[model samples]
Target: MSRTTFTLDDLKRILLEGSGVPEGADLRADILDTDFTDIGYDSLALLETASRVEREYGIELDETVLGDATTPRAFVDAVGAHLSAQPV
Candidate 1:
């Protein structure tokens, strides 16, 4: 088995694409530091993005983390941590 690695930027892209952010929407770098609420993502949006992450990475994310992560950076960190712990 081999481990897969992804960066915060990768996760950011995934979130932008999976969270139903509309076309022509301006996604600024502040997304990395801003709350998802500020970025117009709600619980449903996060859930959808989390599902995408799980499917893409073939890993299970803890529901608590999925639900509680407030910012894109936090989500990226949580997923990265979980992915690092998965068996390779």
Candidate 2:
């Protein structure tokens, strides 16, 4: 099997797809200053999103790290880092 270079947009697309969110919805718009609560992204929603992201990105997100990402930017940064560190 081959691996793909995951990009920020790719991550966003995957999240949207997995979560059944609408197209064009900004995934990184309120990052850094807002929490998932602000965007209606609850724990269940997050779980679904994370599971989807895990499958799409082929990575296992660290719960400890996910806790630190309370905003969109953090999520993006975390996902980027995870993607880089993922085994090829």
Candidate 3:
């Protein structure tokens, strides 16, 4: 089933599975506002994560929007917005 909202937990799981967590990066910590770059997630990693999220959720996420989402919170919010716009 498709999801209606994207949460931080989802991001963490996807990040781990899609790109593998970087060394010394603590995903379990409070990283909502932490910049993706700070945690070793670069544009390529974020793109991969976005691709995985799109495939899993059956929603298309704009690359530009994803690029704008520098933090996990913003990424989740961007995915949530796309999910909400999808047909029920």
lDDT of 3 by residue, 1-88 (tens): 5778889999999999988989889998999999999998998898889889989899988868776899999999999989989888
Q: What's each prediction's TM-score?
A: 0.80, 0.66, 0.93
Candidate closer to the true structure by TM-score (higher is better), 2 or 3: 3
Per-residue accuracy of model 2 over 1-88 as CA lDDT, tens digit each = 2234545566456556756554544556743456766755666666776677777667788886567877656777777788787666
**In candidate 2, which residue ranges exceed 4 Å CA deviation?**
1-12, 18-32
Query: Could you tell me how far off, in angstroms, the CA of residue 84 lies in candidate 3 after the best superposition?
Result: 0.8
lDDT of 1 by residue, 6-83 (tens): 676676677678775745445755567777777777788788888888888888889898666897778878888888
Error of 3 at 39 (Å): 0.7
Q: How accurate is candidate 3 locally (lDDT)?
A: 0.89
lDDT of 2: 0.65
Enumerate residue pairs that collide in model 3. none
